[model samples]
Target: MFSTRPRDADAKQFIAEQKTLASIDQQVDAFHAAQPTAPDPVIIEHPIDPVLQTGDSQLLGGAMEIKSPWSEP
Candidate 1:
C-alpha cells in the first residue's frame, strides 16, 4: 500500500538539500561582494593605413606603383 509518510520524508530531504545549496550560493555571493573589482586597462594602438607609399613618386606620373600595407616589403 502506498503511504503519504514516505512522500513526506522525501520532500523533507529535498528541502534540506535545497537549503544547503542556497546557503553555499549565499556564501559565494558574499565572498565576491567583499572583493574589490578593478577597472579594465586602456590600450592604445596606431591605426594602419591600407595603402603605403614608399618612394617620392607622385600619382601624377605616367605610371605609378602602389603597394599594399599587407604585402611584405
Candidate 2:
C-alpha cells in the first residue's frame, strides 16, 4: 500500500516533473499572449548642421564643467 506522503524516489521524481511541466505551460501561455501582431517602423530625421545638431559637442562640453566649491555652501 502507498503511504499518505511520498515515500520513494519515483514518487518524488513524478512530483518534480509535474511541477516543471506546469511552469513550462504557464511560460508558453505568457509568450503566446506577448506575440507581436504587426511590424512597426521608426522614422527619424538626422540634422546636417554641426552646431545646430541635438547633441552638439559645444553644448555637452560646457554641461560637464565643474562648478566652484563655494557655490555649494
Q: Write the per-residue lDDT of candidate 2 for residues 1-73, one digit (tens) a residue.
A: 7667646877889999999999999999999999965434444434355555456554543222233333233
Predictions in order: lDDT: 0.65, 0.64
The C-alpha RMSD of each candidate to the native structure, in angstroms, is 12.6, 13.7
Candidate 1 runs further than 4 Å off:
1-5, 39-73
How far is 57's C-alpha from truth in model 2 (Å)? Answer: 71
TM-score of 1: 0.46
Per-residue lDDT tens digits for candidate 1, residues 15-64, read 99999999999999999999977545544433433355334433333333
TM-score per model over all chains: 0.46, 0.39
Give candidate 2 misplaced runs (Cα > 4 Å).
Answer: 1-7, 38-73
Model 2 lDDT, residue 57, Cα: 57
Instruction: State which candidate has the highest TM-score.
Output: 1
Indicate which candidate wins on lDDT: 1
